[model samples]
Target: MGQVREGTTWLSVIWRVCNVFMSLFFALATYVQINDPDAGMWMVGYGVPSVLCALISWKPLVSEHLAWRRVADLHVMISSSVVIMLGWRIHKEQITQIFQQEEGREFFGLLLTSMWLLLCRHSGRSAVGKLRVFTAVAITLFPFITWFYYHVNKELRSEWPSHCKTAI
Candidate 1:
């Protein structure tokens, strides 16, 4: 039998952790929704990407070349920055709130796309310029797309805190 490569083993551990985090986020969202209707919707909104990430992680074929760690790092950085900015905008927002914003969700989605592009690039599996363009577009438009979706969806209004009324 072929042994698992060392890199693959480490990658598996990292992916597992990411999956666990996503799962926990999903559970928390469900719990919040059960306990408080208003907050529950916000949790549900955030949980969508978390669930997506978890599902993606489950597929070794999907996670292997995608460099999930690098994508996750970028997501954490970008999302954290947006969260901090939002917190600053609304004095009442807590540091932890940055982790729970829609911006964070979008970051993960964009990160996934970018990582896929990188995979294609490394594998020489597609036209070179295409992946670059896709990565650039995904990174550039992620925040706007997320904000647009959040604002246009009237149902998500309840997810916003009264004090943090302004868009981040």
Candidate 2:
């Protein structure tokens, strides 16, 4: 019983660490959007999650609050809608290399945000599951890895719009 409890505590710590990383990632995402043509929309989109994740990191049970849940739900709804629209556009246009296009990248960004919110939705009410911890680690690593890839392969971004190129 003591061993099981210790494991659970470790999982909780890992989960919070994941949230901390994600909060930083979202903040950086928000920062880079400042150069976007529609900076306000994207800034708010990324900014909300950054704040939400930071709250979770600081207080894991913050998600249980009515206001927090409401804000998260609303953001997820808006992001999901945009994701659907972007998916349709991508399908209709038959975009081959999604990472090569701005809309495609936006699609993935919103999808990531929505998925993370959903993962965190009921977290305050239960022990951090092992599966959730594993998933969080994977999700947390994805954006960083992809960003590094783009940073290293500068040629891939040669055709990016002027605004996209300006991001750090």
Candidate 3:
């Protein structure tokens, strides 16, 4: 529904600040990655869109209009997927030392930022706001769970099996 129409609120301001901060950080990261001679065009492909989306997200908050908010939501959603794919690619590239790698941080950054934006966007409804908050809290725990699982199943994860294995 359109109940969560764009209107400047504390939540919107917070989300806007978050988006601006993330955009700055991602922009800096992209710059650093681009400077690396070994870094290929793929980083640019992901980085450009990510930074653009992050930057644009602020427009809705600044404009404080329903249409702009919707636009920002759409862009954030797109950027979230892009960053997820980018993060996965980085994680895969570090398969040799996944345990030692911090490659998935970007995905977490994107995900958390997106969650906050979504939460703020829906803050008009108490039920939806609570749900978003709950979802954010739950998702925040995933990294720790993943780390624990990785440590416990390190051996299994190290070897990518090609055949189906019985799970009895």
Residue by residue across 90-153, what tens digits does model 2's lDDT show?
9999998898999899999999999999999979898998999999999999999999999999
What's the true lDDT of residue 156 in model 2?
A: 93
> How do all the candidates rank in terms of lDDT, highest first?
2, 3, 1
The top-ranked prediction according to TM-score is 2
Q: Distance (Å) between predicted and true CA of 17, model 2?
A: 0.7
Q: Whose lDDT is greatest here?
A: 2
Find the number of clashing residue pairs for candidate 3: 0
Higher-ranked by lDDT: 1 or 3: 3
Q: Give candidate 3's TM-score.
A: 0.39
Better of 1 and 2 by lDDT: 2
Collision count for each candidate, in order: 1, 0, 0
Write model 3 residue lDDT over 11-113, tens digit each, in one string: 4554445445545544544554544444454354346434543644545433345764675577567757867786778766765543343344345545655
Winner on TM-score (1 vs 2)? 2
The lDDT, on a scale of 0 to 1, for candidate 3 is 0.49
